[model samples]
Target: MNLNELLTDAVAGAINTLYGMRPSLDIIQLQKTRKDFEGNITLVTFPLLRISKKSPEETGANIGGYLKENTGIVSGFNCVKGFLNLIVSDAYYINFINNSFGNNFYGFKPPDTGAEKIMVEYSSPNTNKPLHLGHIRNNLLGNSLCRILEANGKHVIKTNIVNDRGIHICKSMLAWQKWGNGQTPESSGKKGDHLVGDFYVKFDLEYKKQISELVAGGMQEEAAGREAPIMKEAQEMLRKWESRDSQVLELWEMMNQWVYSGFDVTYKRLGVGFDKIYYESDTYIIGRDTVLEGLKKGVFYQRPDSSVWVDLTKDGLDEKILLRSDGTSVYMTQDIGTAQIRQTDFSPDKMVYVVGNEQNYHFKVLALILDKLGYSWAKGLYHMSYGMVELPEGKMKSREGTVVDADDLMDDMIDTAKAMADELGKLEGLTGLEKEDTYRIIGLGALKYFILKVDPVKNMVFDPRESIDFNGNTGPFIQYTYARIRSVLRKASDAGIMFGEKIPERINIGNKEKSILAILYDFPSVVAEAGNNFSPALIANYIYDLVKEYNQFYHDFSIIKESDGNLRNFRLMLSDMVGTVIKNGMGLLGIEVPERM
Candidate 1:
């Protein structure tokens, strides 16, 4: 049994024997004691002081004495003010690790409690531009959360809603039409997506100029509407492209293909991919008829201009627009349609939208509208909202061109890691190809860890320099710890030491190894908690602490240098188990771990 369980039993026994009515102590948590405290578990006894009608000291002393008399787990108990601190025996720590040594450390075997299938939608990027750091954050959270859910034994379907057709894409088409000297990605020596993205930027610049000239030429801005010269040209291009204007359609298809291809590269590099992809071009109208039906059912109202909207004032928000008067679906309408389609396609117990916190209001309205529309499953839908990733300077602004490009940021990280590896003389044995792969793994590992280590709901600063440090609370540090264990395992293997057989031995209740075992025993709880809360940071923190403990053990204990063969084999097994836990834990976080530093 783990230390927490042992302590829980001890505490409950003490409470039952002292209070005489078997007062329940099942809900009591035996959390790790802070460094300043002498005990490993602290129990606040204030609630019981009044019930017992005794002084705080007397109550604590009574419980403490009871625990000491009844259970071997407690070495001693100290009454510190109103809290009862329980010091556990070193033997319990050793027993905990040895018991969990061969089992799944971080693997989550969720109870077979008949959970409903889940749908997670994330990384809905527009085709007109390359993905930026914001998209990276969204993808990571979505992908990692999907893994977390799946690890919890829930059937999870990951989907991406691609924003492929819109005014933004229309600009790209217009710009390509007007500026085309028939230049291709190959001819321009540019990434296909970036090549298309260049035209997108060009369209915005030119469209702004056109708008300015029209205003200067006495065109009424409001009266001009979406039918102005520049706007009309873009709309015409979209119409023609939709109607299969051979040349226009061909260019559209070609440009979209380039963007998709580029997106695939980025997704593969980042170790993220979706199970299914839904495009706005195809599914935009799925919700349109549904909303219209809602209108007939009096679930939504049509404004005088025929614009469709839902009144959300009852939910403490403004009315949300569903569709324009022109019958084109707005963002909300598209989302509603997407959700309906997913219900039909996967029939999940829940649908999770892993979007940013900026759209907190949007998702609130989404869930409300869905529920009002009479989908019973809507109540189970969740918005896995994550905070923005700001640079040291400030928030990343896409319109102002202050955004960090995903490809560029990843490349920069890999290059930085490679440079550090070279400077540390760690690149001597690695070939060019090995170095390239290592750089990718280590670099992406650092980036993913930095993002995942923080609570998803809290806004965090991404300092690229600080995130790559080898000795701090970073990905590299955990990876290095894993690598060290791996090296020891390899040496044992080379020395003809086989660790396959169980040593049939008890755990060593020594200094740091005992602490290390205690942490390892918490693996099941960590996985369950993280998966249940939809937070990968919990697992990240757990792994980081595990590594820290291992590091201390490595410095203080001798595993390979010990003279006793059985002890060496036992320690090797411990090291092997730690390595397994680290690898599995990191994998769940969507982070890669290198076998070597």
Candidate 2:
């Protein structure tokens, strides 16, 4: 029932008859007519000129004549230069729009059969700190991607691989230990993760001071800094904790719980939760064993220092270390183990790693290693690489302590939303808690929309000042549109304005209404494309475009007019359907469509 499909078939048939040869065309895009153009849906005749051996005008005339002769669907046709412009009947547009009402939300249709199962791993946060804007992007993308895939009838497993154990975590432990007061989140009145994060920051400061003193004391001429007292002490603690030193192990477990607890709150707020969680503590040894097996099978090389590596020179890269000299598993090694574990657990048809673009080479190396290890499933592994989230000022550097904390960013957004709501006198009818919830929904909607608006491969700036505007291409605009629709629906319900019709197939299309209908008709194709491309931005862009078109239609036409029962009822149904699509699309992007924002 796709209008483009019907149009393409008709155009291709006409072209074939006109030229005595079949023409190739799939999507005959219906574009808006410009001032010079007599009709929309222009068919460029330049490609046909060589075959037709005629001038551009002659070719266009032949094609336009053939289309008019062969098809009843096209209302009229005009030839201008090399362009054959076809005008589709208003009746056809009306039929297409009316028939779309009963389709699934967002015009989505489930896959016919044999859909592949996919596992998407994203929002892999470290337990040493709380979530930040970077994690927000990951969460939204991952969560929305899952929705998109599901809409396309693919089975999707949304997972998170928590980097819970590392030398960095040991530093926080060291700080808490030497500082001596065993403080819980409750006792310290600090958020669990932030409390742990405070210790992490404390560790860095003290460790720096300790390193400076060591250098002043002329410890090994400052070349062996990692071997200094502070760093070495942190490393020693890591070893002890790994060996399950009773007190150290207990503290590590406790602090990790604190961080995870804090993360749960943030995840709930963001409206994204993982289906499964993988821990480095559990997978590192599995990676070690996998590497050892690879070494035995001659897939990897071991150095005299007892480190294992893969010579990726064949794959246009240097030898990547799979294991450290101390017999510890490296990042790549743990990844291998995680992949194997996931394959065993789910046996998914596709495994998507939603990591940042800086690790593009790393993922390439991983695919090579997996293939070398003789896993056929390795070929199906995909790297969903996204660019780093930069602030309006510049890139965030974690080492420089300039990275934005995820929880803090969320708080700031919420505060901004509340202020805006207060200024508009919008929260006056709501209770304090209801007001808080409203702000949270609007704030998070803005954050998710901003992140998902940009294509994944392109770097985006987080402009705190204007990213959440209600008047333009922003989350608030979409939310307000949905709210307006909801309000209309409520009013209809209260006024007993039934949408019932003897013939539910009637569509009365104005110019603006037809434009909105065209966009609405494209939702299925948009969702499918987004899923295929692994870009939630596609859905985000589609929804924004949909709502924009709807707004234009809303301004140009009245849906609530007391007179003209058929037209008003049809328009109300159209608005309601559009509202459903918007809500569904926003939901896929991990955004809330507030009913009364």
Candidate 3:
């Protein structure tokens, strides 16, 4: 047992012995002692005060005296304001490390011991635009969440739903059809998604110009926007797409292929993939039919204009439309269809939608409507809402100068990594190919770490320069620390020093060494907590703190150079475990730790 469980049982007996009561869990609250206190575990005596019928100090002294005498691990005790602090013996920490020496992935739970199937949907990108900085955050958060759940032993399925058919997509297609001699990705020498995205911006500019002319001719702004020639053509294209017109279908298929081709390159570069992908064009039919079925069953109501909607006023939400008057399905319709199909396919215990915070109400309506339609699994749907990620001002921006493309941001990060690595001579003693791969790892690591380190619910500004720094709470810093540990292990291996099958005997450990053990012991709990709360920031920051502690331990002690053979070997074992934990912990965040820098 760990320190908490060991002390909890001992403290519970003390409460019964002193007060003649079987102590409840709440009454025997045990936690890590405060940093200011000279102990490893602290027991709150205030809870026991009610049963002891004494003052806080008197109650603490009563329990502290009992624990010091009876608990072998409790070497000494100090009491302050009824908080009983127990200084655990050094042998406890040494035993903990030795027990953990052989398990490479010490913190992760076994698969058979955790939750069942879970489906996580993220990177739900539209075909009209390339993934931008915001989608990068979504992809990273979702990817990390999947890994975190797996570490907790949950069977996770990573999925994405592509929004391939909409007025926005039609806008790009219409612009391309009107503007030029047919240009493709091969001809333009640009990424297919970028090429398609360029036309999306072009469509907006022309549509705006037409609206301005109509407004100058005395039309109201809203009316002019509605009547804009380009707008009308895009709407017609959408109508044709829904009906699957041969010409429109041909163009749609060609354009979306270009976008998908581009998305593949970006997804590969960003190191994210989906187990399955859904498309709106296919699922919209399912959603439209489902909504119509709901209307017929009276679960939803039909408006006079023939549109369908669900009434959620009783649930404290407004009415939500499932289909437009012209028979075009709304986003909600496609979502309903997507959920139905996913449920039929996976039968997952939970469905997590990792999208931006802007769509909070949309998901709420989705679950409520699905429940109203008698789909029992609707309650398991969760929205992993996150805020937007913006580049520092004057940095890279999209073609419209508002969004930042994933491809461009990654390029900048890798370039920044190369420049910094070269300047510091960190890339010395490596070949041309090794240097290239290391730079990619460091750059992507910096990017993923900087973004994942922030809480998912908060807006963040990503500065490429700030992220690539070799020191501080950054990816490269942790990566470098891990490399440092690996270097120590390699030298020991070269010197023919290795631990055997038997657990090492308890040796003298100093304050720094003890601190490292204490931090290392919390790894499993940290992974569990991160998985339970769906917060990767927890794992990210936890690894950073552990790295910081080990770095301090390294600077203050001797390992291979220690004069005593036992102490030196123990330190080597400690270093090896630290390295293993670092690698395993970072894996939960979907990060790779290079063996060398």
**Highest lDDT, which number?**
3
- Candidate 2 structure quality by residue, lDDT tens digits, 1-597: 465666677767766676676755532334545647656567777777766778989877876776767776677888776677877666765666566665556446576467788999989988887777788888888888888888889888889999988888888888888883989899988789888888888888887777777788777646546756778888888788667799888888999999999999889888888889999888888888999999999999989999888998877789999988888767898899999999999999999988889999999999999999999999999999998888877988766877888787888888889999999997687888888989998888887888898999998888777775656888888999998998888888898898735224444456666666667767888888998898888888888888988888888777777478878877887788799889888878888887787
- What ranges in model 3 sit over 4 Å off? 391-400, 500-505
- Per residue, candidate 3 scores C-alpha lDDT tens digits across 1-597 of 667777888888888898898778767888888778888888888878889999888888888888889987877888898888878878777778878887987999888644688999999999998888888899999999998998889999999999999999999999999884699999989899999988999999999899999999999999999999999999999999888899999999999999999999999888888999999888989999999999999999999999888999999999888889998899999999999999999999999999999899998999999999999999999999998776677434554486766898889888988998899898799999999888888888988999999999998877756765657998888999999998988888898877534445456777777777888888998998999899999999989988998998899888888888888877888888888888888888777888778
Candidate 2: worst-modelled 10 consecutive residues by lDDT: 500-509
Model 3 lDDT, full chain set: 0.87
lDDT of each: 0.81, 0.81, 0.87
Per-residue CA lDDT of model 1 for 109-171, tens digit only, reads: 664568758889999999998998888888888888888887788888899999887777878
lDDT of the structure predicted as candidate 2: 0.81
Please name the candidate that would achieve the greatest TM-score relative to the true structure. 3
Model 1 stretches astray by more than 4 angstroms? 1-6, 24-29, 104-106, 110-113, 215-228, 239-249, 500-508
What lDDT, from 0 to 1, does candidate 1 have?
0.81
Range of the 10 consecutive residues with the lowest summed lDDT in candidate 3 = 499-508
